[model samples]
Target: MEKDWPSGFPGINWLGRQEEEAVADVVRKGALFRYYGPQSPTHVDQLEEYARTFYDVDHALAVNSGTGALFTAMSALGVGPGTEVIVPALLWVATVTAVIQNNAIPVLCEVDRSFNMDPEDLEKKITPRTKLIAVVHMAGTPCDMDAIMRIANKHNIPVLEDCAQCNGGSFRKRKVGTFGKVGMYSLQINKNVTAGEGGLLVTNDEKLYTRLVAAHDLGVPWKKGLPDETGEVCFWGQGRRMGELAGAVANIQLRKLSHVIAHMKASKQRIKDMLGHMEGVSFRRLNDPDGDTGPFLILMFDKESHAGGVAQHLTNGGIDNVFHLSNYGLHIYHNIRSLVEKVPLSPAGNPWSLSQNSDSLFEYGKGTCPTSDDLFERSVIVTIPSRLTDEQELEMTQAIKNAIVANVTS
Candidate 1:
């Protein structure tokens, strides 16, 4: 018999009142468009205002997707042809997408135990063409800010944090997005704050804020009170505005994020501590976590030299929550277009390659990022995360140990 885990859905709230009225509210009034005017009841404007305040940023632009925020920000920042944006190969596809979307080259860099950018690798990758660095805090883990910032300052490269997976997470007491020049958030259904489908960009620089706002709002400052005529507008932009409904849901969810994050941290630590005791398997330790308590725990299976088992063992031991591909669960990368571009060597030296990348920073195949590749092959990519209770955590611990004892070979 299969064990029924209550949280099969990505972001189902058993005790959320804010989201309780979410569905009904959208269905009743149904003001879908965000640009209705001063009287407009759409929550998108309110959401943007609320996000700006909550995130402590000068401005927050809401958009259709978190990737959209990255794309829009890159465009406004002038990251296009001939520009190089540093990125992590181990991160989500969107991080690279933002760089390529702007027609900029993406120089793949390595990650430290914190799962953030490696400042050493970053230093080596920067060049005259380098314009930006899009760093993702893997699994809501904060990156080494002091190092990343120092490097960015040294090279004058603007950091665009792909914080889609880390909404309420922080770095050295400051919020993740605020640490960089601009930060992007995802409100996709599976994220901490779910609005079905949406994203937000945060910034403190007034000039960048103005540019992004104008670009996001049809090339004008056409928020709630602007006329639909050229007489009131001064420029042109594509319509990437998010509806009020998304903003409404995000507002209420934002309030509960801290509590949820706290719970997740507690839960993640429990797993980490338990897994750390295993002989062949160990949790990746880094300085950024303050030694413990983050949104999730990352355990790795040591290489063939040592005895270890990957997350596949979790399935045999009756535990099933890992992320090899998808952000939510056991999903894989399945973009069909990538097949045609297969190359034999990545600039970093991965033997497998793409025929043609959006930019040159991406190589054919040099078989680089071996650590990520090895871990990807043998890891479990656990996703039980910060939501499970102590009892549930214990059960998972037992299952993992049992799986490892039976599976790890000499």
Candidate 2:
């Protein structure tokens, strides 16, 4: 009999005494608040310290959520009205929403076979109003950071890396987040590491770090556990601070990230090797195979009908979390209703109709990116669980092969 397969909750599979003890210690110490409490709080500070070292960055800030980190980073990088931020089509809704939330226009760039920001399309999207390049490392794979950075440098545009789905992933040995001006990671339950819910920001620029710190909290940089009134960086903070409770769990989870990623990567590679080459199916291109965190496997088919048929066959064969790329919801650029319809933040008709943003008009929806649309219609994405026994891996491999043979070879 085949063993039961695990879901895509990578870090949760490894959770045990460590997380429990960490959380219990915080509760017992009465340090629920990160800044101050009955007992001196240290978990959030320690988490930031460890994150700085883990990502090899000069500074790291713990925030309330991945979305919060995006807003904070964008604000710090000067993404505001009249500016445009270029982003890949195959990104989470939050990535584009962040650009719009900053009162900036979001320009969608086409993703290549790697399912990452196509450096070529990214260049064509840049204009005089372009302010930031928001590169999202989608589905546990890093973008081509070298090519992206080269373009950004040529145009003097700062790059903000959205590493929410690809935490612990790297490109060409350098970590994904470190290559950009700032990198953001999510600690949500579905991420590689879980803190229940939290986020982190990392950067090497001291001035930018100061701005991020201020923007994420009370609009003033904190010094020695207190908000510094005389600080150079000050803005209207959104009050997005990570409490000690989340920090406690996130601190422990971050330590186990590498181990979790290693297990998942090994399992994914083994399954892919077993499948080999199917007549009509091809694996999504990996920019750096060794650098992939490996929580998802994207299979491209020659036809949309073949992909849909394969997806249904996989579901019937008990393969969990299978999705036809077009129906993958908000992850596809055209499926984001608010973006496609150009929904404004308020009734003010701002961001889109504002005088500053008048020249940056662009359309959204299905036909916005023909190249990406073709790829999406003919692709299927399968979730790769973090922990898979030998038997389970074999079962998954056979299930995928059987699905393809039944749908494509038939």
Candidate 3:
């Protein structure tokens, strides 16, 4: 039964002729670069246009990858040595790495039971130097944006929503990315929608949009199909433009996103219903269940040993990508060696040692976020593949039940 279970590559599972056709069109037209080529390139431009409508934002920018979007956004937001950026403990290493890359200190905010940023801890983490709040919508669930935005507004700080995992998710009735000043999404192969590798950024700020455009390209916004060096937003750019090849696929994939999310959400709901309730077994508390994108299901246990046992049992049963949250690799802060050790970017021993960052002293380790550390130790994360047949779902449900019975109930 386990052999029949699908691996959790969400968008890859749904790829077909549509993606192939889009790619073929780019090759046929001989327009590999997004800006210019033998034929006029429009795929990346079209993807951004469609993204604006889909995410309901005024501006959208396509980039090379999700990490590029983060770096570009942080740069446009004026993150530097003197500033601090608040981030949830349960985020991809790229989230925190963006802060460090920008020469800003990342203040770790504890995550509540939602497994997303804790709004209460977020407020406490804010300081006079706090320049941004990077809210990560993790594991297919939207964060508490209402509470997070209120805190950010009170402090007059900007929020950058990282929707890499929860691409189609919303909080309350609003989309996750719209709540922040700038929001970014990943189009990596494992994401809800794939371009194989691409990223999208959305924002309502016109002035900031110009900066984003410049920062993502050659440090100058494009004017009349050429770089406008005279623009006020000029600076050093990261050359993170999305190629036409990726844009072609991403354009079609963006259109299919809602359908992909709908299928995964329904499948997850059905599996959760089948599991029902069990003693000493619980699910992660969603801030808004209606808005969940549903790529992963998290089960909580009373003790770390129980979580470890269940994860091992499920893996032994041939379940793919099951893990005790503590062992979830770079997604957990303590596991990020570069961040935990304050590894400097250069021999200057800067960022941490610079005069501008001297006041923003902090430590990172297992004890830094005790609450999140506890949650990590006692939770089991299971990947919910994008497409699952009735039989596969049944097998998964039964396998989960058996694992819990063997580990928790005993």
Question: How do the predictions measure up, each by TM-score?
Answer: 0.84, 0.98, 0.98
lDDT of 3 by residue, 122-180 (tens): 99999999999999999999999989989999989999999999998988978889998
Query: Candidate 2 on 1-410: residue-level lDDT in tens?
Result: 23456767888888889989989998898889977666664788899999999999999999989999999999888999999999999999999988999999999999999999999999999999999999999999999898999999999999999999999998988888999899999999999998988999999999999889899987899888889999987778878899988999999999999999999999999999999988989999999998899999999999999999999988887777899999999999999999998997999875888899999989888989889999999999999889999988898899898889988998
lDDT of 1 by residue, 1-410 (tens): 13555452234452377666864576567666666533345677677788888888888888988877887888778776767778775666676656655555667676665556677888988887788888877766777878899999888889888777778877777777887889998888767666778899999997887778776767765543664444343455656788766777776777777776777667767776786677667676564564222545566665532222445556555555554321322111222123115322335522122223334544513245554445444445566644665778888777766666776633
Q: What is the C-alpha lDDT of each candidate?
A: 0.65, 0.92, 0.93
Q: Best lDDT goes to which candidate?
A: 3
Candidate 3 matches the true fold with a TM-score of: 0.98
lDDT rank, highest first? 3, 2, 1
Deviation from native of the Cα of residue 410 in model 1, angstroms? 7.7
Error of 1 at 66 (Å): 0.9
lDDT of 2 at 170: 88
